[model samples]
Structures are given as C-alpha cells and as structure tokens.
Target: MGEELKLLGAWANPFSRRVEIALKIKGVEYEYLDGDIIHNKSALLLEYNPVHKKMPVLVHNGKPIAESLMILEYIDETWKDNPILPRDPYKRAMARFWAKFLDEKCVPALWKYCWSLGEEQENAYEEACGVLKILEGELEDKKFFGGNNLGFVDITANSVGLWIVVIQEAGGFNILTPDKFPRLCKWAEEFRSCPVVKENLPPRDRLYALFKARFEKISGSKDAELASRH
Candidate 1:
C-alpha cells in the first residue's frame, strides 16, 4: 500500500477520466472526490491546483499534480508496476503526441458539434468527422495505439468516446455509427468491457437522462432569451 492518492474530478469530463483510467490501470489505490468546478469547487481543489484551479487534480502523498497528461506521466513514474507509457522511446513520444492531440485539437470541434446550432455547427460537425478519420487511419492495423496491449494512447483515444456518444445525442447525429467506424465502434465495446472502466462508468441510461435534462434546460433557456429580443 502507498500513501493516499486523491482525485478531484467532474463526472462528465473526459480530461478527468484520462487520469482516472491511468490510476486504475496502475492498480493504485485512490479516492475520487467529485466536484462541480462550474460552481463551487472543493477547498482541496483550490489549494492543490492553485495555478490551474481545475478539476482532475491528482493528489499523491499530499502533493498535487495538474493537467491530465502530466498527471498520467507522474502516476506512471511513481508506480513501477503496470506502466502506462510504452518502453520504446519513439512509441512514448507518439503516445504523448496522440494524448496532446486529444487535449488540444480534437475536443474543440467535438464540443462545437454538440453545442453550436447553425452553419458553425455544421462546419464543426464535419471537422469532428475529419478528426475521427485521422484516428481510424491510425488504428487501422493496430491492436491498440501502442500496438500490442493497452497503453496510454488507447486509454486517451477512447476517453473521447464519451464525448462522441454525448455529442451524438446532443447534435441528433450518429457520427460514430457502427457501420461507419466499425473498428472504433468495436473498440468502444471492448474498451467498456474492461472491469475498471465498465464498473466505474455511470449507468448509461441514468447518464442519458441527466444529460438530456441538462441539454433541454440549456437549449430552452437559449430559446427563451432569443425570443425576448423580438
């Protein structure tokens, strides 16, 4: 057993899940504390992540680490068993490339596709597919992004599927329909079947109801505000 590891996370966030999945893969014992950084965050969150003031701060041995990718590296380094990073130097670099790619480039268009409601939404919808096309190409012949068994890239890439499903519902489009991205769709099924991920996931139907309610609430507010102008 090691010193206590605590994670401050938002349930719906893929950024947070990146760290969570790494922790689970490492078999490190940790306590997860959920928060709504959108409103009031925990005192520990503020103290631990004074700089970023963000959720998904990983506190290990009372020291805090921020940023999902950085925290993952820290976890990998701290725990020798069940390493998340591939041993090969080139593969490690490629893994980080994909992780950063997800953090930077992939998320924005995905968000816009789910939330935008015009030509802008249409453009972002296309952009999201373009990004998925790149990913599908990368995964074409690979078992996982690290090539054999699960590694950092596999976890990070699949974390985005949470967003993909949510976006599919929000945008009224099935961007990841099994027929279109068979590999990805199959990967999603297998990934979720993993005990750590499958057990940790919020119940799908319950999550759907919560997301639907929030989506309708926000959209209704926007409609009401727009109508008041006329």
Candidate 2:
C-alpha cells in the first residue's frame, strides 16, 4: 500500500497546475483539494505552508512539502517511474538551472510586463524579450528542453506554453510572436499539443476572463494610489 497523497491547489494558479501535471505524468494517485487562495485560504493550506501561505502544497503520508519546484523534485524522487529529471548528473544540473532561471527571471519579467504600465512596462518587456532570446538560443533544434521527453524545464515553463498568450490578450500587447520568437512559438505549440499538457490545461476562456478582471483591478488600484499620492 502507498502513503496517502493529497494536493491542495487552486484552479487558476499555474504553479498549482505544474504540480498536478507532474503527478499525472508520473501516474501518482492523489486527492485534490481545491480552494480560492485570494478570497479564502483553507486551514489545511495554511497549516502545511505557514510561511508562504500559498497554494500547491503536496502532503504525503503526514509530512508536507512547500514550494512548487521543491514539490516537483520530491515527486520525481519519490515515484521513480516516468522520471521528470534527467538521469545524468550534469544534465540534471542543467535542467535544474533552466527551471530556476524560468522561475526567478523569465516568469517575473513576463508578469511585470503584463501588469505594469508606462516606463515600467516597457522595461519589463525588454527584459522578458532578452530572456526569451537566450531561451531560444538554448532550445535550438531540440524537440523539448529535455530533448524528446517532457521533463523538468518543460514542466516548469508551463506559463510560457499557454498563460503568456492569455496574458498578452488581457494586457493588450504582443510579446511572444512567431516572427520574433520562432522557436519559442513552435515549442509552445508542440508543448501544448502533448496529451498530458493539453488535457490538463485550464480552459482558455476562463483563464482569459480571470486575468482580464485581475488586470482591470490592478490597473484601477494603481491609478487610485497615484491619484492619492498626487
């Protein structure tokens, strides 16, 4: 018998989806507890991740693991079947490096570019573009970041595959286009086409509507804050 596995996650969060995808790929059976993190976080979620108080906490047996990347690695280590990380030490290190880079640098820049206005938005767009160029160079002719398999870097870059398009629509901008980022564009298409990725992806319309509301709310708040300051 296997230990009880429970995943506390929210529907719209990409990080939550990332963990879910990993579990699905590894053929792990688990209970999913869905909740609204913005309006009301559940007691279980708070208890598991007291510091971050975030979603996508994986509870195995009685122990809890916080942070999406940490949870991902834990899942890969625990299951051993359909491995997410590479077997080679050097390849594994490279996978980890790219995943961390996407999390720390690219994702932030992309979000900032989508959420901010004026000069801040312009600067963020440039930074995101620079990061995309580097990623494009890395990808080259590879089918995926993990060669033929959907591995660590590919899973971590869930946002780049679909969310970016929804965000671009919501923000009324064009950052990821075929002409500028041909490799990324092709990769996104191929990544999303994968059964594990395609079937599990959040509904595009719902995601668009959610982000549209969020962008409006954020812009309104910023405008109000600026007016009050002046």
lDDT score of model 2? Answer: 0.91
All candidates: TM-score: 0.91, 0.94
Cα deviation at 230, candidate 2, in Å, is 8.9
How many clashing pairs per prediction, in order? 0, 0
lDDT of 1 by residue, 53-80 (tens): 8988998888889988888899999888
lDDT of 2 by residue, 1-230 (tens): 76799999988888999999999999989999898969787788889999999988999997999899999999999999999999999999999999999999999888888888888898787898998898899899988998988989999999999999899988788999999999989999999999999877899999999989988998899899999998
Best by TM-score: 2
Model 1 residue 215 CA deviation (Å) reads 1.9
Looking at model 2, which ten-residue stretch has the lowest summed lDDT?
37-46
What TM-score does candidate 1 reach?
0.91
Q: How far off is residue 22 in model 2, in Å? A: 0.7
